[model samples]
Target: MDEDSDAQVMLRVAAGDRKAFALLFDRYHASVARFAYRFVGDRARAEELTQDIFVKLYRNAKAYKPTAQFKTFLFRVATNHCLNEVRRGEYRVTRSTSSPADEDEKGVEAVDAQAERPDEAVAGRELERAVGEALQGMSERERAAFTMCRFEGMAYRDIATALEASEAAVKSLIHRATLAVARKVEALQAGIGPERSRA
Candidate 1:
């Protein structure tokens, strides 16, 4: 079935179909977990949050409206849960100190080192770290907007719906976030340049 058929499955779930719910869970669990990990930066906590989101989805199945795309509804639920966790100070973006097991289990894409020299690979990892730090420094709304647009490839209108903000506001947040991250990355590159340049 087409992936957009998620709505049909959701309708079935709303009508009390456990098999449909299971299919939906199997389809979206990994994606939701990855998005949560990107937002929270902790594999274990992201897994917990992913479980909570699915539980919410199951409990609120009757509220699913076909008016919007099912993906939008799923992300809206996820965004609210993540923001609440942040507000409660239960979420932390601390990938640097995460345990080896957490890193191994994390679903975020790693810096690709294939066919690259050692120096280039090192630079790639450094750049990835810098970008991650830049994202963490953004305001919650800005980070959410930037991540949805840039990483998740979501349209501004859909993101606005998920965030419950105006499209213009989402655009502004993403614009500022992009500039901030770019500036930080440039600074990181400069800092990592030759020692003679720093002298």
Candidate 2:
């Protein structure tokens, strides 16, 4: 089967095409999950948030249009849904990252080792933990702007469009977010090991 452009898929979806809907789901579900995970710093909430975005898409498929990139439309919907959720204060969803009892019994060292390269795993875990903590520390707009720009690699114009802010404003959001996150990461690295410090 020929791969359809997202806009084409949406056009089909709007016409009640189940296959196109399935294709969109298959294409974006993971990205949505990761986007949520990066924002909320909780895997479970990330999963829920991702599902919620797709739900909105499914419900609104009839309204789909092709004036912009399909991802741009998808992100616009996703960003708005997340922002509304933030406003409703419903994201206080609670979950835990504590290791399962079975996993813990295996070995703390085994759990700590996450990278394929044995030598890199310990540092990688620490870095990931630090970044996760930093993400939790950010404001909603900062996190959204930062996540879209840094994680998704969206252009400034697209981000400004998605966010409905000026390019300058978008840049400011990303800059402030980067500075704040970088400071937290630097502080964390400083507290680790002298040999571990890259800067």
Best by TM-score: 1
What TM-score against the true fold does each predicted structure earn? 0.83, 0.77
For model 2, residues 121-189, the per-residue Cα lDDT tens digits are 556655555554455667777777887787667888878877888999989988987776666567756
Q: Report every candidate's CA lDDT.
A: 0.77, 0.67
Index of the highest-lDDT prediction: 1
List where candidate 2 sits over 4 angstroms from the true fold. 1-4, 39-42, 92-116, 192-199
- In terms of lDDT, model 2 sits at 0.67
Model 2 poorest ten-residue lDDT run: 102-111
The predictions' CA RMSDs to the true structure, in order, are 3.8, 6.2
Show how many residue pairs clash in every candidate, following the order shown: 0, 0
